[model samples]
Target: MGTREIGLPQRVPGTGLPARVTIWEVGPRDGLQNEKAIVPVAVKLEFLDRLAEAGLTTLEATSFVSPKWVPQLADAEELLAGLNKREGVRYPVLVPNERGLKRALEAGCPDIAIFGSATETFAQRNLNSGLEKQFEMFEPVLAGANGLNVRAYLSMCFGDPWEGPVPAEQVVRVGKRLLELGCTQLSLGDTIGVATVGQVEGLLAAFADAGVPADKLAVHFHDTYGQALANTVAALRCGVSTVDSSAGGLGGCPYAESATGNLATEDLLWTLEGLGIEHGVDLDALVKTSAWMAEQLGRPSPSRVVRALAG
Candidate 1:
């Protein structure tokens, strides 16, 4: 897709929001990775095309992890091969280790992401490793991602399914380590959607105090408790310009049964439009695309904005 800019609204004095925000679309990778039914590769490619047509420039394409762990994305290589790579649009694959990194590199993936957990319990459960060991596992992957855009996703940043509240200090510590280890960006994830506005503010403040600029961080929220939009506003107010959301709310935490879907891209766009922030995404196109994908999944979209607009 050729680069295009949507006219930005004039910045209102005293408003802390940025002139433009980048919505990192994670539907193909994070959204469908946990689904019980495996999606066909052709459908996956069509989904990606629709997203690009809707002007989503940054998309998480697929994950190069062991299929045994995530069978839903078993065709990651095939999906990458079949993708219609667009100009000025990024398709970042997820690499869990050096092996995954090698696979992604072999497939000619130019961008990749690694995931870590803030709490020890989740680190052990999700990664099958302790907190420190998980970082050690990522070291080689980050090192091998030479000349590639490597993003770090820190999961369970606010609360954990096994453990309760995660400490702000620990989130800062691990997040700083990921940046130090060569991640170009850090996406703080509320994996279980338990983050409150106060927790979001506290974590951003802690990260700021630790000298990690907001420009290098992105926020990923789930709407399990209906706080995704509220938490997103908090992050934006804290100067975070990048946000991760899935189309049609097409995601849930496989590890946490209580967790619902991710913050819908349509819903996020609705809020950004209302706030007069420029994101360059066509809300109607996005909703229509998501509604079509939901049909493929044999369910209605869980996103309120999509439902309202599609109605």
Candidate 2:
């Protein structure tokens, strides 16, 4: 939304990767929310179209949270209503509570992701309730979603903004609770982007030790410290496949200071290619789409790969 800032591109860490990796694009909801200017629904639709054309199958379209909380996505209903659902591509909305869930369901979002913070402070700040109380809030929504066969996602599994370096045990504990609460997939979010490879390993190891299956976890990292892709490699090495990212390297939590975009989809795809990991995405297409969205938003991309390529 301003003048461009040129930067160096960083190579992803780790070794020969898997054949394919799934990219869960969150740009529509997460990316736009951080912009000072409200993005038009037409622009949002165009952005989503480009992403789907680039071979992205899963996307977080919008959040059903109160407009008072996230004015950027206040048009959540209209946005969802206008989306031209592409076959095989799953568009999920972030339903914050029962009310939000109702709106998403009414808007006909077949898939949804319910958010619950791992730390009490974040839960209170974001959800207006304590950790235990947040679960209570999710109970009915989870039950309703389970009945309707909707998906759920939990956030802040790595580190919290209010609380420093969340304990590995706590991560496992919260993860299990969400899994038990009927979350189809649990995304371990590095909310403040303070996670390291070793920390990711330990966190996943703790989950493994807790008898939670590896197939149920997703890794969501922010590139605030330029370590998201590195941490993602670590998770992949640990056999965790599902990764949450945003195109053009967009998004950061409002509550988290200095937090940057979620891991760039372009950067992630490049890493997957280097590792022999398979992701159904087209790297060149992703770069083009990223540039288009950045142009629409009137801002330069936060993605290192995009910057390097454009430069």
Candidate 3:
């Protein structure tokens, strides 16, 4: 079949896609947090600057978690302080709990993100708590994010390495609770990248049934199983407009042994362009940024778009 037959919008004269997709770039925080080698603060700042120059409006800057856990982001405060803070660009930092939130506030962070897991094992492994205890932990943090733009991430929504397929109902319940706790947005995560188009559709259907508007949700997919782009298409068709991706396909869950790099922002942008989607990102600039970041990491980018553009 053709692209038109699949119901995706075609490009119009002097205009982009019918829908304007928001690409939430997570390379700075989620992408680099797992690296064993520490990246210099100057290099990190340069990377952030490059992304901004590429027209990425929303970027995950850094995590205010304990230095002992994620030493890579230990310079969170310094990074935030040194950032150019471009106008019209949002830099959201990840805060694990009230303590992290306090640190973020002290650092003058205007936006924060909290992470929750949908399944028991992942909850314990990532947050070091049972399901209910995890929510208890988030209560104070959410309560503290009064004047900030808060985003909640629900990981392992599709499938868990420890426990196979997760039920869509469970994800909806957790997502609803997060929204009730005052999270302005919820990003459903396929942490292991095992989600299929059917699973994405089913999960969105469940969210709709639970009164969670598509506007209130974003999708985070890893490219581990090579299904991230397909799942993203499924999500867009279901009315989801925001997506989380890492430049150069950087990032892997430190807790999930089977997890791989996130969906590449450049690849996602390519797909968006093909669908005539209106995202203000500069694809060539994004590719150049990813290629430079790969050099900093002493390797080539895993992103297909970067490779193709580089060639």
Best by lDDT, which number? 1
Model 2 misplacement above 4 A: 1-17, 146-152, 255-257
246: Cα error in model 3, Å: 0.6
| lDDT digits (tens) for residues 1-311 of candidate 1 | 11222333344433788889999999999899867898999999999999999999999999998988889888998898899999989999999989999999999988899999988888888799988889889988888888899999999999987789999999999999999999999999998889999999999999999999999999999988899999999999999999999999999876566767799998898888878888998877788888889889988888887877675
lDDT of 3 by residue, 1-311 (tens): 00111222254422322378999999999999978899999999999999999999999999998999899999998999899999999999999999999998898888899999999999998899976789999989888887898999999999988899999998999889999999999999999888999999999999998899999999999988789999998898888999999998998865455666799998898888777788999887788888888889988888887877774
Query: Which runs of model 3 end up more than 4 angstroms from their true locations?
Result: 1-18, 254-259
- Model 3 RMSD in angstroms: 5.1
TM-score, every prediction: 0.94, 0.92, 0.93
Badly placed stretches (over 4 Å) of model 1 are: 1-14, 255-258
Global Cα lDDT for candidate 1:
0.90
lDDT tens digits, residue span 1-311, model 2: 22234332354544645446788899888788888988898999889988999899998888998898789999888887788889999998988888988887788777888877788888887778987888888888987774554454555677776677788888788778888887888888887788888999999899999998767888889888889988998888887888999998888766566767688888887777766676888777778888888888777898877876664
Superposition TM-score, candidate 1 onto the true structure: 0.94
The 10 consecutive residues of candidate 3 with the worst lDDT sum are: 1-10
Q: What is the lDDT, from 0 to 100, of the residue 232 in candidate 1? A: 98
